[model samples]
Every structure is written in structure tokens, then in C-alpha cells.
Target: MGTASSQLDPEVTEKVSRDVNDLISKHRVVIFAKNICPYCHMAKNVFIEMNEAYHWVDLSKRPDGREMQYFLADLTGQSTVPRVFVNGKCIGGGQETQELYKKGILQNLLNQS
Candidate 1:
């Protein structure tokens, strides 16, 4: 399978592809989310508590949200929202983010190479 992009109009898919790439490249943290997703909210809370700002892509509000989520599934190996990334790497979702927080690894990951 190529990616979720294949499901979209090729033009939109291409643009979202570029947007996703730009986001992961330029942001320290990124979350692919829907507006009402609790997990996505929880994930954002973790970063906020850290006093970190992240790129929050509210897919529900975007025309390309679904396609982007599909692309993210390919990138992170997960289809769920609240897909979190740090330092240009997929760290995971709500529970995973919390686990890392509880272990004190989240801080380390924030700044590590």
C-alpha cells in the first residue's frame, strides 16, 4: 500500500504530504488529532504541562485531515489520532505519552538527539 494519500484527490494528497513533512521537520512536537478526541486532548495536556508548544493539526477541521491521518499511520505505524511525535520521531499516543511521562523519559526525549 502506498499510503492514505492514495484515497484523496491527488492534488490535495500531494499538498497534505508536503504539509506533514514540513510540520515534522519544523516542530519539536506534533499531534495529529480530531477536535473531540479525549486521547488527543490528553496528549496535548502532557506537552502543555511541560510548558512546550506543539503543532496541533486538528484533522477534523481540515479538509485533508483523513488523508493526513492515513499518511501518519504509514509514518508512525498507527492509525489512531493523538499520534504524537517528538524530535522528528513518532513517540506514540495518549497512554504511551503518559507512560513516558510517568517514567520521566518524556523530558529526556524532548531534548535528546
Candidate 2:
């Protein structure tokens, strides 16, 4: 997988990079994933259930999203869907996100943000 910065068009890439940066800068949690992905769905569901506010980027819809897919692959070395980020840090995929949730660390991060 390529980094989000690598897969985007000059314009879209700039936009997404800014978007991700702004999200990390303004919000506590951000999730980047495809709508059809089950793990992505689960991650969203968890956030919804907890009533936590998060920014979700649906890479399947946007032209720049393909770039994000590559970015995810490059960073994680896995082709898994639903790559998440917290506080400007890559937090891995759905299972890892869930593990953080299970460990009660997700809430802590959210709260801290």
C-alpha cells in the first residue's frame, strides 16, 4: 500500500493531506476506510455506539481515495481495509482498533483529544 500522500493527485492529494492534517489537528479520532468493508463498518459502529465524534473518510467514493488506499498499504504493509488514525498516528486496521477499544484505551485517547 502507498501512503495517502503518494496515491493522490496533485490537487486531491493536497486536499486530502490537508484534510487529514486538519482532522488530526481539530478532532480526536479519524477513520479512513471503504464503505463496503466489514471491519470498516464495525469500526464505525463502535464509534457510533459509544457516541464518540470522529471524522470518517470513505476512500471508495473519492478520486483521491485510491491514493489513500495505496498510502495505507505502504504504511501498514497490509492490504486490509479500514485503516485508522489517532492524534496523527496510524492505529492499524479494524481488529487493532477494536483491540484498543477493548483495552479501554480508545476512550482515553478520545477523551484526551
Candidate with maximal TM-score: 1
Model 2 lDDT per residue over 1-113, tens place:
74545645677666655665676567667788899999998888778878877788888997767766665566567767787777777777888888889899888876665
C-alpha root-mean-square deviation, candidate 1: 1.7
Query: Residue 62 of candidate 1: its Cα lDDT?
Result: 87
Q: After superposition, how far is residue 51 of candidate 2 from its true place, in Å?
A: 0.8
Worst 10 residues of 1 by lDDT: 1-10
- Backbone clash total for model 1 is 0
TM-score of every model versus the real structure:
0.89, 0.75
Estimate candidate 1's alpha-carbon lDDT, on a 0 to 1 scale.
Answer: 0.87
What C-alpha lDDT values do all the predictions have? Answer: 0.87, 0.75
Task: State, as a TM-score between 0 and 1, how close model 2 is to the true structure.
Answer: 0.75
Give the top-scoring candidate (lDDT).
1
